[model samples]
Target: MAKELLKGNEAIAEAAIRSGLEAYFGYPITPQTELLEWLSRRMPELGRTFLQAESELAAINMVYGAACTGARVMTSSSSPGISLMMEGISYIAGTEIPVVLVDVMRGGPGLGNIAPAQGDYNQIVHGGGHGDFHPIVLAPASVQESIDLTVEAFDLADKYRAIVVVLIDGSIGQMMEPAELPPMQPIQKRNQEWAVTGAKDRERRILSSIYIDPEDEEVINFRLLERWNEIEANELRYKEYFMEDAELVVIGFGTAGRVALSAVRAARSEGIPVGLLRPITVSPFPYARIKEQTELACGMLVVEMNSGQMLQDVLAAVGGKIPVEFYGRMGGVVPLPDEILAEIRRLCYEPVAPSANPRISWMNRMNITKN
Candidate 1:
């Protein structure tokens, strides 16, 4: 197989087709619009299903309908569209239906403009759909990452009998890079021993997250939290770069993660002991892994496109063992590597007052409409 230059959105669309998704139900949303456009044509040509739903509500319901039939399904939307689909996602989570939701996140709150912002971090990772559950979320920072993780998202969704989200943003979805196509093989539909598609000749499976009784709901919550704990123990994944002998560590994900990577490389050239903790799975956040690394650093710096969403998680994970600082450029404006590298230098080598705040805020931030 040969590799080709593809935008992150295009890579995801191509990977989905190659993964043999039975259908895609989505409405056009910026950043991810090109992906829907690409798949709408190719899926029909390949004798598959692609429906441009009238609205986010309709599209998510379409996903609900399709997943009920034991189909591999997906949908793409930005922040607000994803907000509208929350009800459906909660229903799907409650029923334990298998699904994959792609959130090419843009600026959030209301109709935040079509620039990349990860403000949806807490919402997506912390049960945005209203339930005591954690969806398997794969956060990819590059075009190749988008392709690889899209296919893995479906697999994980099926494996867990739950929703899996590939969380990205405008730059990753729109930026171009080279990626190789994998051979197509039909993903085995999850065995229906537990799912509630229909009972052909046996006791019917019931997929419902609702329990009327408070005790039963409590039990369900306990079971769900236990399951999440299991996931955290076994599935929390992250990538570490240049951390063996580092004085400061930089943490980020998605597009911000990529930018931080560049800063890490630059600091390395200048002989600064800088490392990176780029998380691949944000839902089962790599708290333990981060804690392990922070033990060796002077301080940890969190860089994101939001007003320090992930930074909170870092603080909780740090347990005040070391000072944790945040540097961000929110709204549509993403921080450049050179800008981040400057912050890295300040944190790496600086004299400060005992009460001085180390946070860095770039001047070119955009106004974010919070929802």
Candidate 2:
């Protein structure tokens, strides 16, 4: 009802609770530990389940088991911790159960730091585990968005019988902002015909990811692909700013997108025709929208907190119709508005050729020597 100054991690935890989350299983991990900590106290008080598992591996499997019973279960972790849960995640995907995962990303390729970074974009959006399935990934730029997306993740997961990931960086997880949380939803109990509740007095129902026959596994793969097609068609989402009659466009997501917006505004004041396109849904990326922008914009600048992970997707969407440039800060380093503003200026005055590799150009600009 009223807005409160809330930390991102705690807000997301509370939002999940209000959305009728039935169980939470997670281990303590930096940047996201507050989420697990908040739930540890709140869940039990509400007579719901909260557990600090032995490890990230154990935590994900616990979520897997709980979700099998048609419960609204979730688990949260940082980058390295999420890596540990990949195999279990693949299992859940193969079994076709709805589960919510919150990944508050930190600097990493391997346990880098507890600072903010968007390095896990490829891992989460592209599917890290061994699978032919696509997980619905939503990226939020602010605490309010984090809270809202947390609630949406559950609904999307259940609707598609798929995994839905609410992805944000450590900065968003740790920052405080004034935001309104949704009212607590009464938990609705429904008999899930597909769940593995005791098959007492009825025909036994079995749910398993294992398919011994190649033909059967192929069938499963087709089913997953068909569902993914539906997601791509119905779920593409993004935000645009100053796009009307702009010739140069900038694209980013999450914190990087937020930072880019400021840069775009500064450039606009300087008489540059620059706009911003921020994708809220990273998976099932807004390819069509980006393609449409190619006709209106002369060029684009892709910005991120990593080494241009989303840049690849932008390239695919643009399809060589226009030149695309990239600028990024890696290893937990967040780029400033000024930095992106400079990139926007360059994109306007000295555009690169469509055939040029943006990442290498960026590396050269940053003075990073090729090995």
Candidate 3:
């Protein structure tokens, strides 16, 4: 297929369609409204199910119901909208149904602006839902990656009967880029043995998240943990840039990571031995890679659009073996490449002992007095 200039939200929507998405249920929210808008028109033309629910809560439950039928189902929303779906998400996780979710994150703990932000990292990566289940989270930095990961989300969701989340910030969702989408795939009839299809000649299959017996619930929890262990083992994905002989490493995801790549390149031009590690699978984080970098790299920098959410993960991976620094612009403030470049320059030339609290140091630098 020839490459075309495509908007990220629309590209992802079409990619899901081409991937044989059978049903979509979502309420329109900023940064991701285009996705639902595109599907509103395309899904009907393709004779697939498309619904605009009353709200995010309704939308997620609709997705949950559709997924139980073993259909390729999806939903998209922004940060606050995602929060509203947490209970439904937990239910889907407990039921062990396959569902794909796209989160075009914007700012805030509340009704923040529609600007791009990575604040949803902890909420989505760690569980916001009340449960003992973990969802597979994929972060994409570019529009092209957004399209590709949308397709991958469905496959992964089905393979393990798990929830797969494509977590991108608002910037990627609103950006435009030249990308090639996969050819349309024919929708395959689902024959999942565990699916709650009609029991015409065979015994009925019951799928529910509720287990009244405590021991039965414990067994379910164990099953979830074992599956999570397998996912962590096989699905960890990341991309390394200029790391062959890197002495300083930068870690970020989505737009922060993409911007950091530019900074790393700038630092390299100035003869700095710096590299970048962008995690594609955030849930199954690339801890092993970070651990390896600790052996070779003198120091590490973590950049994010939130207040050091991923920083904690990197610190755990480093295990205090090397100095770890953090830089962030929260509340929808996207950091510029030059800003990250400056941090890299400091890491390379003006080395300091790792602070007891990196966020405190960062706040001091930013002149924000923590009250």
Deviation in Å, model 1, residue 133 alpha carbon? 1.0
Report the Cα lDDT for residue 148, model 2: 92
Alpha-carbon local distance difference test for all models = 0.84, 0.94, 0.94
RMSD of each: 3.4, 1.6, 1.5
Q: Higher lDDT: candidate 1 or 3?
A: 3
Q: List the lowest-lDDT window of 10 residues for candidate 1.
A: 362-371
Better structure of 1 and 2 per lDDT: 2
Model 1: CA > 4 A from native: 187-190, 351-371
For residues 164-225, what per-residue lDDT tens digits would candidate 3 score against the true structure? 99999889999999999999999988799989778999999999999999999999999999
Sorted by lDDT (best first), the order is 2, 3, 1
lDDT (Cα, tens digit) per residue for candidate 1, span 1-371: 88899988888988988887889999998988998999899989888899999999999999987887788889888888999999999888877778899999998679989999898898788856886788989999988888989888887787677788999999899899988877786656556677556778888766666789999888877776787777778777788899899889999999899899999999999999999999999988988888887668878888999888888788778877777777887777898999789878977787333233434332222222122
Per-model clash counts, in order, read 3, 0, 0
Error of 1 at 31 (Å): 1.3
- Measured against the true structure, the TM-scores of the candidates, in listed sequence, are 0.93, 0.98, 0.98
lDDT of 2 by residue, 131-160 (tens): 798999999999999999999999999889
